[model samples]
Target: MRRMRVAAAMSVAALALAGCGSSTESTPGAGGASSSAKALKIGMAYDVGGRGDQSFNDAAAAGLDKAKKDLGVETKEATAVNGEPESAREERLQQLIDAGYKDVVAVGFAYAPSVKKVAAANPDAKISLIDSTDATGPNIVNLTFAEQQGSFLVGAAAALKSKTANIGFIGGVNTDLIKKFEAGYTAGAKAVKPAIKIQVKYLTQPPDFSGFGDPAKGKTAAEGMYQQGADVIYAAAGGSGGGLFTAATAAKKMAIGVDSDQALTAPPAARPYVITSMLKKVDVATFDFIKSLTEGKFVAGTKIYDLKANGVGYSTTGGQMDDIKAKLDAYKQQIIDGKIVVPAKP
Candidate 1:
């Protein structure tokens, strides 16, 4: 499954290089639940931690919320459980589609196979997949992000704000996708301070995805890094990031967030330690997917959201990044202008 994800990303890169990163097509009479005569009904399948992770899944939920209010769409949502089998994911999606939900959004790469299988079985269903390009079909739309680019910015922020010049990264899972986060973070930090000391840890390996949802493991990993003289940490560990934030607060250190503006979404007690966040813009992709269906312009292909497309970005909600925003923005523009290339792997 993990290898498939990497290959899928490489395929997406090829598409981008070929000038086919994204394109709209009229799925004539293939609207499924997107009928123009009735309210659009959307079914959202979220990764672990659902709406309150204050990270990835929450970003998806925010899109759903906006669609509800702005588009007046009817919607239903479901979440995956830690360590569940792929069959479970398939069944969850099958249930949503069987219940007359013609438009379904699966919110993580773990659902790639399930989305492919379910969509193939249900020809009338319109499926939007977040975070992976492994699945493709007439009805399936893959929404992927340049997480490395955003992580690079926050990684630069960590290096710039680190008083000890020693920072850390905690990944929820040891996979190619999360490695992109590590790669960009490492490259960005080194770009700023060549001799900086950096520590890295992964909470779990594949088939044991609890790493993405386990706060206790995140806290333990972060505590160890902080004790080893790292003054700032960046967490790409979904719900586990909450634990990292807690650990940062206790250590009187700083931490970076991923997928959302966690300085504004993290638990109140841990907010102060969040210097900045890597914005993945899942909400924007989610809304755009639904909106396109409404406009009869549902695009059926891989869409890569990168620094150039404003799909990924950095957030400075708490003014902690005020001091160095200029430098970070400069780096961001360099990446956009192709003057600096952020690596997708470390």
Candidate 2:
């Protein structure tokens, strides 16, 4: 899906958006959840690794935490197990629904199928499916981010900071979802300096979500790139991203992190090497979705959160990225003005 373009650092005037790529109205969905359901009981189901993945799942957790503090909404959370049956997803969702939750969120691309099935079965429950821009369910509103847009910014940052003019990109699973990350990173780096070398690898192929959780494999993949003269590595490998940080520090190089600001969330030993992070703003989207429901304006459709909406951005913690801010801003403005359109595929 296409998104409305905006300056990467521009402030979003309104947090609640209705349509895809643009913010307007989150209208009450027709067939899914009962928007009028009493007492907001929200639940969120995380992808594998649950709370401590320190990447995607942690970002979503931030949203849930904010909802609890600001909205004072009662909430429940669950995580997936790798070897479980396909029915496992539906069962987790059903358990929450049975436990009196009227609103639930499924985090990750893998949840698209189960969210579709479960949301259809529970027509009166509001469901928010994160990561699938094209996800559609009877009572679900898809909360997706323009990851490519964010990836581009960090890619440019890597180019600016690289001493060897060589960087690497590591993805958890090789899919259209992660491809967006690779595509944007490559495009952004090239835009800054042609002939820059990018080493790309995925932890695993499709049907293997193990990529997101395997730090050992991640370390091996990133270390390979580091040995090849890559000075910076941008990793969108969820928990596996930790290995990228480790390798970067050991090699005396820089690293970029995904989802949350790894410069802050990463372990102290790995923090120094995290030059910056691509922030997905998942927490903002999640809280906004719940806000829509509570406000009686919940809309069910594919909503794309992108640079324009501040849905995707880069972290500036520890002043490590301070030097390259000007260059990053210029490229960001170019993308916003449509002078440069980051590709969704590589």
Candidate 3:
């Protein structure tokens, strides 16, 4: 039954990815029963990639669903349209708050400023923002992940799986958040294979966040790495990772995914090309936050998810990862035990 459910979910995700179906919106009261006497009201605003990137935004949506079921929250969502600027996110956020949603959650670092602004104006409201710590309002809860630990595991996997000594990294932007993934990945690869060669590329330079959602440019960047003899490419570029996956599939190389279990996100043509994924448990974080709010234990401060708490790690699904499961499990244990320290910056 578990396997069947996984299959069904994968099928739905594939349909959504193919544009044949719409993104799934969580229905209020979907979660079994509310543990609290009062019904919770939750709102989520997605980053530029909207909800179908099969990565961060999707994982956040999953958490909202769990919240709706477990806490009887009435949920609402606002997705960023394609080509929308960071400034536009503010409008969407304010719209949700104006509609009377008390617990608003923003799913990307880009939403930090908007969340800060909105949370301040609505002090009585509770707000949560993931992948960012910039919002310091008393009404806001900032959720961050120790992404370095997860990237370390996958970086090691990339090194072990590479037929060539060269590995590549493609990021959405050069911000500290994305750098955390690159730095950790590089360090992990070097730790496992001392002589490994790394090629790093960013989709955007300073002041440009649009690159995170541009898959075409990501594909172009990845093609250059493939030409330079990189056998494995790890992408932390949100929707842009789709292009990296496309390039990897065409080149018959390996691609490491981010945020969620991306083995399930890859197109059929690129499925076999994915080596593994660096996972940040965004869904768990979302559900946990909503649970806290429902229990009246919501705190306004920075909350971190790290390896010791199973908040971040690598994938354990199908394909090449299956063959390396034992070794990966051992590495994960070592990291959790403090025997390994992954770098957070490059």
Best by lDDT: 1
TM-score of 1: 0.86
Worst 10 residues of 3 by lDDT: 20-29
- Order by lDDT, highest first: 1, 3, 2
Q: For candidate 2, lDDT tens digit of each residue in 193-212?
A: 89999999999987888898
Q: How large an RMSD does model 1 have? A: 15.0
Q: What is the lDDT, from 0 to 100, of the residue 48 in candidate 3?
A: 62
The C-alpha local distance difference test score for the whole of candidate 1 amounts to 0.90
Q: How accurate is candidate 2 locally (lDDT)?
A: 0.85
Report the C-alpha displacement of residue 47, candidate 1, in angstroms.
Answer: 2.2
TM-score of each: 0.86, 0.86, 0.83
Candidate 2 least-lDDT 10 residues: 16-25
Which residue pairs in candidate 1 have backbone atoms (N, alpha carbon, C) closer than 3 angstroms, thus clashing? none
lDDT of 3 by residue, 250-335 (tens): 99988999998888878988988887889899999999988998788988999889988889988766767878778878888888
Error of 2 at 85 (Å): 2.3
